[model samples]
Target: MSIITNIEDLRQRSKKILPRMLFDYVDGGSYDEQTLRRNETDFDALQLRQRVMVDTSGKRLGRSVLGQSYALPVGIAPTGMAGLYYPEGEVVALAAAEKWNIPYTLSTLSICSLEQLRGSTDYPFWFQLYIMKDRAFTESLIERAAAAHCSALVLTVDLPISGQRHRDIKNGLSVPLRFTGGGLFDMMLRHGWWRRQMFAKSKSFGNLAGMASAENSKLMGLAQWCASQYDPSLSWDDVAWIRKLWKGKLIAKGVLNAEDARHAIDHGCDAVIVSNHGGRQLDGARSTISSLRSVATAVNRQAPVLLDGGIRSGQDIIRALALGADLCMVGRPYLYALSAAGPAGLDTLFTILKNELEVCMALMGIRDLSEVDETCLENPRYFSREY
Candidate 1:
């Protein structure tokens, strides 16, 4: 608990607790991992403006996204193997989101089924759908989400083909973890991990296991399923069809280009998240933060704009908001927090972020999140001189 000071601290603990394969699977990126590094560093390039003599007491972080008010504009992005991190990782994350009064998006690949989540949690959470070749199955998933009373449908459009992650391939990362001799030996060294798994018997993928009974008793690897099922030919027409099936808010994720952003708007997407699947897809793709302003301006701010990828601190959140991202999502940071110290760690993360944001707002001389707008950022003079 004491070691959990920042996201990096959680990462270190998770690295020690989880097996090498699992840690690499979550932390590593595709190919060169250039985009991954950029996702973090690009946010650093954006500088914030500080003003003096403005009151910042009692500043509120509450926000509304797609007609729903949130205690914080931040939401947990969908991660596939959350269950692997700690038993029922999705449950832990959703529970945390519920406690924080923010939206929690369940991944299409989640181990915990929508019903399981809905039954356990009171409020409706958002659902992220990955279009598959089987239109019937995809439609069925959307229908199930609807049945679960999901408030929003997030359709990920970029991963037509899975990115080549060297670490996953080398480590043989799968859902029902294939325990090799090395893996078992590693697990043995991690006495704490073994104790938790053996005693709690929480290694099961709660949501997905029952849905597919044949693989229920056995471990099901997410990468293998994704490789087999992710539809490569998915297009805008699919989005239109899914939108019709889902009556609630529809958001398009993996949007990087302005043209695609416009297309998302054309299909009536309530919002579009400018993400490269957290650098899990398109290895050298532009950072979501770098692409935010153009995409937001391209859509003419007509729809709510959300950004994800490389958001580690409150300053990064502020930078995104100042650059036109109405809301943002963080993936690994929350996942790390969950893996390191479970619910308490996550609570610590939320408190730390809230405090960091308050300090930033106060230092920037703003009393409200709404007031911390694009004007608070000083666009590079060299870049602006061309204008």
Candidate 2:
């Protein structure tokens, strides 16, 4: 009920409002979480070059990615079960993104279906695909996204198997929450949160409700079905197959190395997101920021390279752009903001980021995104080192 001014404030508020299981699902990372911790720490390691007494007027944050212009370079990275954080959360985030004129990516596991999202907003949003063991269902998802008029297909190449998050297992996290006595007690303590979610539009996974088997529609059943759906056999050949099926711009979302990035370009992707699934997929893999320069160098502009993971502020966004990222995507920060307030929370979060970015750009003597490059970093030598 207080003013949520920053991402940390939103995160703390989200912790207070959301149930432990739901909060952990968004906040926790896999295994030892070395990669997760490194993701943010590495950004701190890169310092921005500060310039003074320059004409900072007429500054613009707008940039185009995959041929679509945005009010800002940042996009809402897809986070599944967003509705669990707040009522109809994904829809709220999409609406906020549309109003802000930036992209909002809908996860295949999102609580809101593509159709529901399409019905809610006239703006075209990107769709993220998670290939499943059920090839037919995977194809069907692509078809559905196309029918919904998705602007791009973000094929998440990682996550052949869900990483083991300690918190999720300990908390007994499941959809349509299987409440233990402790969990119920926790929910009871947050009566306001309970009432809002209880009254909110829908709790079921909208996209998978019809496709999921009856047995898979229950609490733990959904988890089991989701785990079983991940196909370990997924390969580059599958990406080619998907390319043949999808006519829109294709973006491979989990590239961490140059070889993989090159594969994405060779397979005809329009962009490659240098990401590690926010360190949720691989625990000890190098941070996305650390890998950005090498992957960007390899791709050599064959396709635009975007970075996702540990992007918490506009300063971080600028650092990514300096390190060779064409754009950036944020996941947890926006979710925390949405959970803290709602649509208004998102509006505030975007405003804060935009303002911070503008201020940073002005300080760097840069007036536009095109002016941002490796030269904007205080220490470009760190980025020049071989990965």
Candidate 3:
């Protein structure tokens, strides 16, 4: 096996180890994936101003979000059915995050239940919600999160309707995985992944236990479930309704504009995660980084502003900090690590990123994350224009 030193290494390994359907679910974005490509490219366009001759002995990569202290600012972003990456991947992911003193967000569509995960980790984590058309079910989920001791409620506002991820349809990705002749061949090639998946105790969406009991539930699938559940009428007014039910910290995810960012604050969101759903929705939309500065400016420290999408490395995390993001939520990178390797892979990924981030900061003469502002960039004034 090759010595893994970076996220790309893990990604390549994951691609080889997992089946095509599962790998594509983690890797491929929606439609043409223009915004997906742009997410990374936009971050690459921004350059850091390397500084020299400064004290660098006491740099610590730490931050507090929602009254919780993290050893690093990067937290696991919610991914649907994360357990498919490895056997009980979400459980392992949470355990790893707890070990590192970071956060793990459980997706509404997770294969592990909040109650189950609550027992696995010592510390509390965040929960991501997609307001269902069934308000009763939505309220039940909120109640369940509270019961699970989830610290914050991450209200995902972007996905009013499901985006057409071309890969999913092409791969015929579904739960219980109907295998084509080629798929069977592919599975034979990747027996290790198949074996792990077969042994997974609660693979049928643990969060949605008893929700799909029919014999053909696997063919019915989560996407179809999402289509049926997601309320298209989800508006800012719904935030008030949710706010009434959830007293914990509320973070509005998927805000791409300043108006919406500020409006999230207006609707009593504790934080705003600037995302385009990792470019899995709105394929032609602006990259999260491109829109991040404006959203950050709009929130203006009234609430924490975070960025998600295309954060493949610690250098990318540094780019986000310079662009005015308070914290960054990582999706694909963690999944890559968890899927490629096991618990150790996740820990190694975190270590590599930590080293990269600190080195990047130290080279730029930054001793703390607090010092990481717009000044750290070559074009600090690039975001000076009105939104």
Those runs of model 3 whose alpha carbons end farther than 4 Å from true positions after fitting are 213-219, 383-386
Choose 1 or 2, whichever is better by TM-score.
2
Model 1, runs deviating above 4 Å: 199-222, 380-387
Clashing pairs in 1: 111-207, 112-207, 113-207, 175-221, 176-219
Per-residue lDDT of model 1, residues 58-116, tens digit only: 89898888888988878899888787777777888999998998888998877677887
Give the alpha carbon lDDT tens digit for every residue of 172-256 in model 2: 8877677798888887888768888888787877778755465355635555777778988899999999999999999999999
- Residue 306 lDDT in candidate 1: 93
Candidate 2 regions exceeding 4 Å error are 214-219, 385-387
TM accuracy, model 3: 0.96
lDDT tens digits, residue span 1-387, model 3: 249988889899999998888889889899999999999898887889999998988898999877888999799999988888888888999998889898889999888889889888668899999898878878999999999988999999998888899998988888756779777788779977887888887776777666554323663765566567777898999998999999999999999999999889999999999999999988899999889888888888898888899998888899898888888988998888888877988988899889999899889999999889888899866545556
User: Ranking by lDDT, best first?
Assistant: 2, 3, 1
TM-score of each: 0.94, 0.97, 0.96
- lDDT (Cα, 0-100) at 364 in candidate 2: 88
Candidate with more favorable, higher lDDT: 1 or 3: 3
- Rank by TM-score, highest first: 2, 3, 1
> How many angstroms is residue 103 displaced in model 2 relative to the true structure, after the best TM-score fit?
0.4
